[model samples]
Target: MYAPQADTRLLARALHAERITAGMDVLDVCTGSGALAVLASRLGARVSATDISWRAVMTARLNAARAGQRVQVRHGDLSMPWFGRTFDLVTSNPPYVPARDARPPTWGRSRAWDAGRDGRHVVDRICSHASALLRPRGVLLMVHSSLCDAGATLTRLEDAGLRASVTERARVPFGPVLTERLPWLRAQGLIGAEQDWEELVVIRAERS
Candidate 1:
């Protein structure tokens, strides 16, 4: 039971403006509702999308079918099975909510929103494999809450030898986070107490 929410419009704009063309290889990791993959298919790209959640995978397939597009949606862990497959483009909206109990209720307590105890588990893994997943000159696009450390993400990606940048920023309200962890984040200097409680960021990077 998924809704028809499409890929974030900003993401669509980036894809459209970029070099994605017919017959190019692409993968939309996370593939929630398959919106990005569907859009890629419409651009004539041979797209494959994967999600760990069975419901999300099925929903993506249904969404692609509804749009009369052919996107290969598979139920698999991020970047598995297709380990050796490099792509012209890879995208994801990873769970970066820092901690399971540290997010607000608007994020809905789903595993999809939580990023384990540190909120970096999924994203860190994505960055770890990004270089190997992309073709030469290929790109990786990801969005995460500012609650997570965007800089660290970029740093790790760069360490992997990929050219990374913050391509976009949006002040979307993510609702709220657990109050108990506030002191820890502040003490760790990861976030300031005066910082706005709700915000998200989108980052785009390219593989060398």
Candidate 2:
């Protein structure tokens, strides 16, 4: 299961800032350990969460239970389980690290963070489908590394007909995974030669 990190914390803070009232529905995609889902439920929203890994699903369920919060946690691809349902709010902290592998890992610890080359394997899909999962005027809060290009996310969300912007940003030093990828990232022009940190951004998009 993916442990909560700076990206997750950033998303959680962003979610807490939203005006999520009682009875409002919230969906948390790529819910690694159900932290955000439980938080949303604590805020009085009806929370449902999904993850691609069964381990993560179980972990989320366990966390929710321990928190005394009711979160409907399921094992499925991002947003796949809630196809026909639209929520008042959606949240996600997906895999956004640029990786050596051309395709994201389907199984293993890497599945939690190793996205394809540009680190958008999951981000792009979320951008494409977020609007569809939200009710009119509903909101989507998602966090990702700026290495993937927050600009692209904004463009995609706007093209999806939702008003979007980077609502929060935090610079975090590179961890082991990123530290190992420094040379490749630098060669790919995803980071500056001396860059040892990444800027994480929380994108807020609203359905019109």
Compose the digit string of candidate 2's lDDT tens values, residues 1-208.
6678888889888988997899999999999988899999999999999999999999999999999999998889999887799999999999999998889998999999999999999999999999889999999999999999999999999999999999999999998899987999999998999888999999999998
Task: Estimate candidate 1's RMSD in Å.
Answer: 4.0
lDDT of each: 0.76, 0.93
| lDDT at position 94, candidate 2 | 91
Whole-model lDDT, candidate 1? 0.76
Q: Model 2 shows how many backbone clashes? A: 0
- Model 1 TM-score is 0.83
Per-prediction TM-score, please?
Answer: 0.83, 0.98
lDDT of 1 by residue, 1-208 (tens): 2332222665776777777788899999977778888999999999999988888888899989999999988888898957789999998876666653544223332656667656787888999999999999999988776667888889999999999988776664324343556666677666666864545556778877
Model 1 weakest 10-residue run by lDDT = 100-109
Off by over 4 Å in 1: 1-7, 100-109, 176-197
Model 2: pairs clashing at backbone N, Cα or C within 3 Å: none
